[model samples]
Structures are given as structure tokens and as C-alpha cells.
Target chain A: MPLISQQQKAVILMADDDADDRYLVQVAFEENDIQCELLFVEDGSEVFDFLMGQGKHEEKGSKIPNLILLDLNMPKKDGKQVLQEIKALPAYHHIPVVIFTTSKSPEDVRQLYKMGASSFISKPSSFDKLSEVVRNIGTYWVETTMLP
Target chain B: MRKQTLQFLYASLAAAVLLLLSIGVFTFRSLRSLIEQSDAIAHTNKVLFQTEEVISTMKDAEIGQRGFILTHDSSFLKPYVDATQYLGRQLKLVDSLTNFRPQVVQRQRVRRLFYFAQQRDAHIKQLLAASLEPNRPDYDLRLIALLNRGKATMDSARIVVDSLQQTEKLLLEERIHHKDQLSANTLGLFTLISLLAVLMFSLAFYLLIQEIRRRQNYERQLEKTVSDLLRTNQDLEQFTYVVSHHLQEPLRKLQTFSTRLVQKHAIELGDNARFLMERMGSTANQMQTLMADLLVYTGLGLHGDTTDFEVQDLAVVFQKTVENHEKQLSAAKAMVQFDKQSWPVLGEMEQLELLFSHLLQNSLKFVVENQRPHISVHTFVITGEQMPFATQSQHDERFVKIVFTDNGIGIDMQYQDKVFGLFQRLHTADNYPGTGVGLAVCKRIVKRHNGYIHLAATEVGAAFHIYLPLAN
Candidate 1:
């Protein structure tokens, strides 16, 4: 498992418009006891800025994320557009994108899957369910799955 | 614009009637003229017949005189005696007939012919009387000369009769030609009028068809507008669901924070603070449940995904609903009994399960003191007329009426209709912990199945009569 490797650390990037959601995801990730570096962005455009190591993220120790949790509803650019761009680009195409949104619409689920989304999850109403979903995602992507 | 079209149609009809009337009048005039010409031709024929009869009667008189002159048989003079009277009457008839303005020349010839006929008659009578005498000077020469004179007079009468007959024949031919021309013109006019009437009627029919087509187009446009409004309404409902979800976000945060505040800081927060936090959490939970129930009420069948509906047994659905309230039923030790008669109902199973669950929960919630909840499911077959809200669904006219009776506080007859409305409850939240959307949801589900649900008045407990259409 990637987490069992002592020398290496997995990086996870989450993009959401709501600050409380971003903070709650961090707490939920920590509550599962899964050791991973979690990064947060306010919107979909900041996701690109962080990935490109530009603007405020232009530091020497900046790292590219191994997994991206994308929110569908955001200002300037939506998660769908960002997902399309990340999938289209050569450098970030291999990184798995998980759609985390409040929409439980079947059409959104089907469409996100069709647009090369790795997984789709409707935001749970309770913190317990949120923690449980976050644990599953972290365990599967960071610990269980093999990466290049 | 329609009025203009109708006015034009009326005008065209009036023109058609006027044209037909004119054609009729013209035909009548032509027919009348043709009849007059026919009468003129008959008059000419009568004149010609009379003239020839006058000549024939003269020849008959001359034969009688010759027979008497040769044999001196007085009985042969009977024909000559008869001719004198008959010929006089025939001449008078001819004179009166040809006295009209059109037959003036024929009338003059008839007068001349009458004079010649009288002269021949006197000579024949003189010869016959002379022959009867005993002796006379130059008797043979006189008889021969008198006979020659009678022959001459008959030739003159024949010539006048021939001329008069020839003029009458010409008049008959002219009258016949005029009548033929008149009928030909009438026939041409009749054909033209018939063609015009056909054209006028075709134009009116075309106008009517155009008006009908325009109305059909308008109806289609109205239908399109109504469907557009329905689609807009669907979008608004979806938007409402999303907005309500967003609104519940803060309530969720409050609930979580209040719970965490009590769980982690019970020692730092006094009993009063903890109790307040607990109350806040409970309030948030109630609000969340209300929001969720509201969402469910707004979102029923919004996607129109009823393709999973099938013929399901109503007893099984009721059983599943009972299972949903298994914990409550076990605690209450409720007695739930279904009739042995099979209930084959058609619907989406999950919705039916929800519907029955709401009814059972309502019965459980509304209870008399110390009364064990006893529910009995009864079934019967009924026709459409027996059901008040019967609709012409894509099913048969026969329906299966399911009666669900429970031993609980029965609803008042007046409040029976009111209970089905959204957010309408008889008891306060303290008495019955609910959002008051259960019966409304049941009504919606029943309506989706093309059925009806109504509260029936029962002397004992509450009875809900559900009428579901049968499918053959």
C-alpha cells in the first residue's frame, strides 16, 4: 500500500466553492486516520493555478496532486470544464478526478461518468457519512491502488 | 378576419341565388314564347285543313250534281243537299279562324274561295232543277255548258285554297325556327349558370376549409404553449429541490456543531448550556426533517420515471409497509390482518409501499389512549360509477377498491377532505411528531396510478377507501 511506504507521501487536492465544505473534508480526511497531504482550493480555476505552480503556488516545494476531488458547482469555471481540461492535458491526464457534488441527479451521475470521471459521489448530509465516504476514497486511492 | 370571411361567404351565396333566379325567369320566358309559337303553328294548320276541306266538299257537291244530271235519280241529289249546308258552315269557320292579324292574307283568300264555292253550288243546283223539268230549249248544250261552268268555278276555289295553305305552311316553319332558336339560347344560359353555381360553392367550401385549418393551427399553438408552461413548471420544481437542499446546509452545520459542543465540552459547559445545546440540536433535526419531507413532496415523479410499474399484489405491498414499521409495530404489538381475498393491483411497487406505509404510520400516530393499533385490509371489486374520482385511464373500467380500517381516532367527516392537503394536520407537532405531508404524498401517488384515495366515514376507527383501476 502507498501509505505503508515510509519514505513517500500521497497528495490529494480538493476544489470546492464553499469554504466550510473544504474545511469539513479536511477534518473528515483526518478523522479516518489515513495519512495523506490534503490540499484545498476555493474554485476550479485555482485548481489549475495550483497544478501549474503559478501565482501564490509558485514556490519551490510545490507538489503535483496524485488525486483531485472536484466540486461541480463553482464560479468562473465549473468542475466539468476543469475535468475536461485535466483529461485533455498530457501532464495531468493520468491523475484520477473524483466528482464530489451536492447534486443527486441521475443525469449528473451518468454524464460525469461519461466525461472521464473516475468516480461520482453525492455529498452526504451528515458528518459521519462524510467521514465514511472520505475514508473509502482515501483508502482506495492512496493506500489500496497502485500508481505510476 | 373570420367575420370578413363569413361575410364574403354570405355574399357569394346571395349572388348564386340571384343568378339561379335570373336563369329561372329567363327559362320561363323562353318556354312561354315557345308555347305561343306552338299555338301559332296549330292555328296555321287549322287554316290549311279548312281550306282543303272546302275544296273537297265542292268536289263532292259536283259529283252529286253529275249523278243527278245523268240518271235523274232524286235520291242521288241527297249528297248535293247535304253539301250545301256543310260547306256553308265550313266557310264560316274558315273565315273566323283566319280573321286574326297574323293571318290577314289567308283571310282575304278564304273570302275569294267562298265566293267561287257559292257560284259552283248555284250552277250545280240550276242544272239539277233544269234536268228535273219536262222539256227545255237546247237542253243537252245547256247541261254541258252548266257543267263546264261548275268545273271552272271549282278550279278557281282550288287555286285560292292552295295559295292559302302555302302561306300557312310558311308561317308554321317560321314559328318553329323561332322556337328552336329560343330553346337553344335557354340551354346555353342554363349550362353557364350551372357552371357558375358550381364555382361559387367550391369557393365557399375552400373558405370554410381555410378557416378550419387556421383554427387547427391555433389549437396546436395553444397546445404547444401549455406544454411549454408544464416544462417550465417542472424546471421550477427541480430548482426548488436544489434550493431547499442548499438551505438545509446551514441547518446541518448547526446540528453538527451543537452535538459536538455537547459531546466534547460537557464539563466546561454547565448543565444549562448542555441542555440548550441539546435543544438546539433537536430543533435543527426537526427542521432538517421538515425540509427533507418538503423535498420529497416537491420531487415525487418529477423525473416521470414510472417505467418500473408492474402488476404487484396489494397484500405484499401492505406487508412490506408493515415491515417498514416493524419496530413500532412490535413495541405496540399492533394487530395487522389482511383479507384472504387476493388483491392484484397495478402500480410502481415502491410508491405503493410508501403509500401504504404512510397510511399505517398515520393510523399508528393518531391513536386513542391505551388502544392497541389494529389494522384490517379488505378488498372488493367495484365499477367506475361507484368510485367518485373515476377517470378514463389506459385501463379497464373495473376497479379494485381496497378498504384499510384501523382502530385509531377516526377523522371528522368535515376534516376528511382537508387532511389530504399539504401541511394539513389535525394535531400539533407535540402530539404527533410529523411534517404533515403523508396524506398529500399518498394522494399524489394514487393520482399517478390513475386511482383515487378518500377517507370513508366509519363508526369505529378510521377507514381509508382506495380505488385502483384494473387492467385486463
Candidate 2:
């Protein structure tokens, strides 16, 4: 499998309810110059709608996202519930899901992994670390593994 | 008193009672034994007197028989004749007087001897009075036959009677020995009883003294309780005076700062500054709530009012609280579910109203954004048939279970312990806004009424279980 450059990568889906947290993550990604189409949803409910080709993402031309960054705490449906729903569906089961949240609980990490999350990362407390994390995640996702 | 102290007091009192009972039993047993010894001594005396009478009758019969044979005189036969009748009477009397075996046997032997002597005297009188033929050999032969018959009979009877008399004497000696042994045993038993009585009495005395000391100690403890209460009263007074004086300074500062900020810095401040100022205002308000709750908590502990007031309808209080927070509930689009079973609880109506309102407000305030809020209220009564602690009982010290649940921004498991602390807050002021005094106030109120609160679970949302003890 040939490696795709960061610029060639398709959209990466992000789900989070906190506006400040989402803005901070976006700023970190831009500062690190980890280029890919970044698509965002406000919560797990919206994430499900986008994935299932319902609500605002019913157009078939919009490509399925290559990867997902999930936050655990959200309205309507939490990230843990979304992870469980996604893993249960055969079509979306192979798509890599990474848990990204402000919660540093070991219990949360254990639970997310148990639900078939690809990786779990605590949302970095400082901006500098968050920027570094964004760059590394981007490098690994875009330039390394072959997308299904 | 502590449970350990109460147990010690009960144990000491039981020991004292046991000691007294043991002494009483020992005294009763000793008196019974002394009466038994006196009865045994009286039995020994009767046996000895009957034996003596039998010996004297045997001696008189032997003397009279000897006098009649030696003198060949009818006048000498008088003692022998009288002896026979006397011996029969003595034997009958001895048999009636004593149960002793040897004495009765002796009396029978003496009667046999006395009868033999009388027959011999009759034969001698016949020989002396006869005036028939002078045939010497025949006469001598007759005399020999008569003499031998009388001698053999008398000798056999006398030997048996003497042996019997000796046997009776031996039995009398044995009876005296037995009496002495019984006396010794009684004395020993008496000494033992006395010793036991002394020991038991000593124990009782010691226990009595100990009881007195314990009673004194208990009195002292009561005195200490009174003194402690007095000291606690003094401390509370000092606390009220000092805390009131101290609290006024901070409150005055808060008011002064707010006034100054409004007058002088209102124009210079940005959005962040105004936001900080609003938070400051909330903190002051929270402190004021805390002080008022503390006052009520202290008052509840001090005053217990037993009144015959009927249980006020909880629905009224609920309506008033909902009306007060109607704006917030409407904004959140919250729903309230109440089980309207009238539960008559003994409590101050105002305090109960405050407790329920605070809980309801907490449920409404912490709802997840864009989610409709929900609250459920209900009453459950426990009967004696149900397992204890799990059941809520009426008019007993058993708890009235009140569970408040909400699907909100749930607290983490680690922060559960800190929820009821005076100023413990998990979220930053930028996110969820609270002064962290509400749970503390709830804790104080619950504790004042001898109730308890605990965070039941936080799996997806928060659940708080409050248990209030029902009054008997």
C-alpha cells in the first residue's frame, strides 16, 4: 500500500460538544500544519446522522471520513454510546475511531478500548502539548496506515 | 454514654446481683444442715437405754436360780419365780422401746433363761415334798434327770443371753462411734458452710462497695455531662459572638467593594471583569445562605419541640417551591414527577420545605444542555415485616428513604467524597456555576435531624439518596 501525503488525505470527522475545546483543537492542528479536511459535528447524535447518511449529510457525493476523533462527554448521546453503535455496525466497524476527551480517567480509557476504540488520548491540558499531539496524530493517520 | 460505657455498667450491676444471691443461698443451706445433725444425736440415746434394762433383768434371774439350788429352800425360789415374770415384761418393753437388733435378741434370751429356772424350782419342790418308798437308786436317778435337764436348759439359755448382752453392748459402742462420726461430719460441714458463707459475704461486701464506687462514678459522669453541656453552651455563645462579629467584616467588605466597583470601575471594566464581579456577587450570596443554614442546624440540635400539630400537606410546600423556581424550570423545560401519598413526618415544616426545594433546584440546574430535565419524588413506608435499614418505617427511628435522580453532567466517582465538604467544587466557574455550599448545607440540615445523605451512583447521571429518621 502506498503512503498518502497529508495534503492528499480525505476528511477526518471530529465529534465534541464543547466549543472552546473544539476551537482549541482546530487552532493546534492549524499551528502544526497537519493538513487534511477537518469535518466536525457537535455531538454523538450529529456524528451518527453524518455517518448513516441522514440529517444534513444525506448527499452520497460526500465521502465517508477516513478517521474519527471522539470526545466522551456530549449531549443527546455520549461518545462511549456512539463508539458502541459504530462498532456494532459492520460497514463502519473497520473505520479507525480514536477517543479524544478532557477526561483522564483510567476507567474511561479502559471502557473505550473495550468498546473497540483504536486509541484513547486525554485531551492535553496545555496548548503546546495539544499542538504536538495533533501533528503526531495527523502524521500517523494521513501518511502511515492504508485507509479502507 | 458511649455503648462501651453502658455495657460496662450493666456488667458490673449483674456481678453485684449475682454475688448477693450466692450469699443468700449459702446461708440457707447451712441452717438446714445443723437441724439434721441434732436429729441424728437423739436417735443414739434411745438405743443405749433399752440395752441397759435387758442386762439388769438377766442378772437378777441368774442370782435367784443359784440361791434356790444351793439352799434347797422354797423361800429362795421366790426371786426365781418373780424373775420369770419380770423378765417377760422387760423383753416386751425392750422390743417396743428400740429398733436395735442386738438389744431385742438379748431380751428374748433372758426370758428363756428365766422360764428354765422356774421349771427347775418346781422339780426341786416335788423331790423335797415326796413321802413314798425308800428306793435310793431310783430316787437318785430321778433327781439326776431332773437336775441335768434344769442345768442344761439354764446353762444354754444363760450362755445365749450373755452372748446376746455382749453383742448388744458391742452395738451400743458402735452406735456411740457412729454418733461421734456424725457429730464430726456435722462440725466439718458447719465449718465449711461458715467458711463459704464468709467468703460469699466477703464477695458480696466487695461487690456492694464496688457498686457504690460505680454508682459514684456514674454520678460523676452525669456531672461531667452537665458540665460538658455547660461548656458546650459557653463555646456556642462564644462561637456565635465571635463568628457574627468576624462575618460582618467580610460581608461589609463585599458590599463596599461592590458599591465601589459599581460607582468607580463600572465604566473601565471589560466583559471578563464584569463576569468576575458577577461571580463575586454569587459567592457572597452563597455565604449568606450558609450562615442562615448553620443557624438553623444549631437551633435544631438545641431545641426539640414535641407538638400535636398535624402533618402539613407536602403538596403545598412543593407548589410554593415550584412557583418560586418556575422561571428556571420553564427555561430548562424540566418535568417534575411526585408521588402524592401523604407521608406524615415529624419535623419543622419550614426546614422540610427548604430541604426539598434545594434538592429540586439541584436537579433542575445540572441538566445536560438541550435535554429536557426530569425529577421524581415519592414516599415509601416500611413495616416490621421488611428487612431493617432497607425499609422506611413510620413513627420509628427507621429512615424515610428519599431518592433524587437526574440525567445531567454527572460527577466523577473520585469527586464523590468531596461533594459534601464546605467548599469543595469539581468544575471551574467558567463551566458549571455553583458556590459549593448547597450540598454542605443539605448535609448540615440532614445531620441536625439525625438523617444521612449519600451519592448512590454516577454511572450515567447523578443519584442522591437521603434518609431521614422518623420520630416515634
Candidate 3:
């Protein structure tokens, strides 16, 4: 095992539209004792603004979210459109996207995987299930998987 | 197929008739010719036998005359007398038999010779009765004179007879020639008719067989068309499955991400963040619902194992749907009304349950906050040409009506069309926690049941009117 760095700890970013779900994810991370910061966005449009360092997210030393946790359905720009734009753009093309949704549809599962999503997770119905999901996601992205 | 067979049968019958008719005509002609030839041959043989009989009777007369001269017996004279009568009768018969002018001339000559022979016999009698006197002496001279005249008469009669026979032979030759010509002409006509009949029969048979083959080809084409249509249906089914499976994959990701965020960062996030998170959750839920609806929509025309689906009581399906939505009804404090009477309907149990559940769930969801919801479910049969296909769908009559009424926040008329669209929501995310695909799914199921649903006028709430096709 190698020593973890502060800059590497800030490498991963999450973009999601739901506030309670974001809070639950943070709680799961705290419960698992994983020291990684996750970012959030209201929808796909805001995520783009945050990535390009424009709009309300434009500020000095505001770092870009390293990874995105996209919600497929949203008002201004859904997860699917955001995933397409991010993958299309040269600047943000290297950023990994992991879809997090509450759907059990097989189509959504296969499609997100096709669109280069690193992983897809169903919204856990219970807090315990949510904790386990977050722990596994953390282990895969942080320890088991390689970074860009 | 039966019609073609009948045509073929008729053709075969006509052909057989023609063939038989041709054979009959040929046989008739041949038999007629044979009969004519046999008649000619028999006439010639009879003439020869009649001539021979006349000659034999003359010979017998000559023999009797000779015997009377030699023995002077009365028995010989009797034979001569019978011979004379027979000869006279034979002469008359021969005259009737012969039409030639020369034969008539010969008959006159024969009559003269008979008279000469009688005169000679009288002279002989006078000579025999004369005494040995010089006065009676010269009977030989008279007898010589009579004999010479008789000989002359006989020679003339023979010459006439020979000329008459020659005339008869020429007449027979002309008859035979005409008969041959007639027979040849009749045989030629018979052969031509037979050939023509055979040609007509063969042509008709060939045409009939060709028609049958053409009809068979048409039947085969019809069978192929049906098979092609079935193949196209299978392809459409495959396309639906592929589209449903592929389009749903991305929607699942949207739902997952929304839940992940709410689970992780709600406590640390601001009010704006919380609002965004809630909106995200709403959107994710909507996508999930839309995907599910799409699945059902694509799978709508698929027919499962069909069994005896008799008309079932609507109350059963209605009660089941209500029970499924018990929790929601309890939460909203909704008072649902139903007609407990068994209203029979022809429907699939699972599909009918889904349809009713979706409608009732909508009624329960749209209740005014903190207000008791009032819902009613009822069904009625209609008759006398007032049917749904006539009045609602196709403007015909005879129908069954199912009325579902609810005392809830009524939808605006402008949003009616939008309400039936997949994921079309009329209210804000915070007020209503639904994907808005319920009404669309209900409409689909209703349409499958050969029914139509429309918004009925509501005084204080929302009312839905459904019309179903009635079975006889």
C-alpha cells in the first residue's frame, strides 16, 4: 500500500441533483471512515458550468470535480445529455462518470454502461444498504481502480 | 378449388360427349354404306335367280312338248300346260322387275313367239287327225312354214332379251358407281366431323387445365402473402423488444445518481442544494416510470396464452385494485365508493387489475391537502344502439359505461392531453411525487380492452368516463 496524498484525495468529484441523497452519501462516507470529498450539482447544466469554471461556480481556486455522479432525469439538463457533452468535450473527457439512480430498469443499466459510465448503482432503499454501496464504490474508485 | 374441379368435370363430360357423338356418326355412316351395298348385291342376286328360273321353266315346257310328240302321254301335256301358266306369270314378273325400254321390247317379242308355237301345235294336230288321203297330205308344208315363223320369232325374242340384259347390266354399273360416290362422300364428312370434335374437346380440356393451374397459383400467392405478413409481425415484435431494452439502460443510471446524492450530502447541503436534490429525485423517479410505461406500451399488442375468457364480474377486478391501493387510500383518508353488484365484463384479469389500479391511484394521489377524498366506481350496461363504438369510437350504438369519479384537485382542461403523455406532470415536484405515466398506462390498457376513457364534467373534483364495447 502507498501513502495517500491531499491532492489525490481531492481528485474525485460527484455531480448530483438531489440534496438528501448527497447528504446520505456523505453520511455513508463518514460511517465508512473514508476521507474523500464529494461535490454536487443541481442538474447537468450546472455541472457543465462548474466544469468550465463559469456561471455561479466561477471563482478563484475553485477546483473542478474529478468524477461526476450523474442523475439521468433532471429539468434543465439530464444526466444522459450531461454524460454525452462531458464525453464529447476534450477538456473534461478524461473525467470518469458513475451513474447513481433509483431505477431498476435493465435498459438504463445497459445504456449508461454503453455511454462509458464507470459504474451504475441503484438508490439504496435502506440506510444500511446505502452505507454498503458507498463503501464498495469508495474501494473501487480509490484503491482498486487507477486514476486519469 | 371446388369451383375449378367442377369446371374440369364439366369439360371432361363435354369431351366425352363429343367423342361419343363423333364415333356414333362414323358408325352410322359406315353401317349405312354397308346396308346400301348389301341391298345392291341382294337385288343383283335376285335378278339372276329370277332369270335362271324363267330359263328353267322354258326348258321344262320344251321337254313336255318333246315328250308329248314322242310318247303322246297326257302327263307330259299336263307339265307343258303348268309350264305355260308359270311362263306367263314369270313374263309379267320380269316386266315389272325391268324398267329399261329394251326389256319391254324383249317381252313383246316373247309374246309373239308364244303365239307362233301355239299355231305350230294346231297344224300338227290337224295333220294327225287327217285320213290317209291326198287332201290332207301336205300338212308338212304348213308345219314347215309354222316352224320357220316360230324359229324367227324365237331368234328375235332372244336378241331382245340379250339387249335387255345388256341394258340391265349398264343400269347396275351406274347404280354401283353412284353408291360408291355417296359412300365416299359420307365417310369423308364423318371423318371431318370426328376430327373437328376431337380438336374442340382437346382445346377445351387444355384451357380448363390451364385455368385450374392459374387458380392454384393464386391460392399459393395468397398463402405466401399471409406468411409474409406473419413474418413482418414477428419482426415488429423483435424491434419492440430491442428498443425497450436499449432505451431503459440510461434511465436507470439517472435514478441511481439522484438517490446516491440524497443519501450522502443532504445534511451538509444548503436549502438550494436540498431543493435541487429533491428535484433530481423527482426527475429520476419520473424517468423510471417512463421507462416502465414504455415497456408496457411496446408490449401492448402481445397476446399471451389465450384460454376461455368469459365475461367476469367487474366488481372483482375493482375490489382487487382498491385493495392494492389501500395504503395510499388510508394515507389520504379517501372514501372510495363502489357498486358491489357483480358487473360482468370480458377482460383479462391481470390487465384489468392494472388498469383499475392506475385510475384509482390517480384519484387517491390528487386529493386536496388535508381534505378527505371521495371516489366513486360504478358500471352500467347500455343498449339500443347507444354503444361505445357508435357514440364514442365509431359513432355506432350499443355500449357499456364505467364511471369513475373523484373529489380531488381537478386537472385543467388545457393539460388533459399532456396528462396522458409518458412522464407528463401537471404539478410541481414537491406537491406531487409521481412520474405522471399512470394515466398513460391506464389509457393503453383501456384501449386494449376495446374501450375509451374521457374526462367527464366534474362540479368540485375530477370525473373520468369510460366506455367499453358490449358483447352479444
Query: Which candidate number has the best TM-score?
Result: 1
lDDT of 1 at B15: 76
lDDT of 1 by residue, A14-112 (tens): 999888788778888877877788888888888988988877788834567888999998898999999999989999889889999876656678888
Q: Tell me how candidate 2 scores on lDDT.
A: 0.66
| Tens digit of per-residue lDDT, candidate 1, span B24-106 | 89878888887888888888788878878888888888888888878988888888888888999999999888776565676
The best-first sequence of candidates by DockQ reads: 1, 3, 2
DockQ of each: 0.20, 0.01, 0.03
lDDT of each: 0.83, 0.66, 0.69
Candidate 3's C-alpha runs over 4 A off are A1-148, B1-41, B48-52, B74-164, B185-218, B262-287, B297-472
The C-alpha stretches of model 1 lying farther than 4 A from their native spots are A1-16, A28-36, A41-148, B1-40, B46-137, B144-214, B257-283, B305-316, B340-346, B391-396
Top lDDT prediction, candidate number: 1
In lDDT terms, how accurate is model 1? Answer: 0.83
True A-B contacts kept by model 3: 0.00
- Tens digits of per-residue lDDT for model 2, B169-243: 676576567656766765676566556656655655666676678899999999999999988976885587447
How far off is residue B53 in model 1, in Å? 6.9
Ranking by lDDT: 1, 3, 2
Worst 10-residue lDDT window, candidate 3 chain B = B125-134
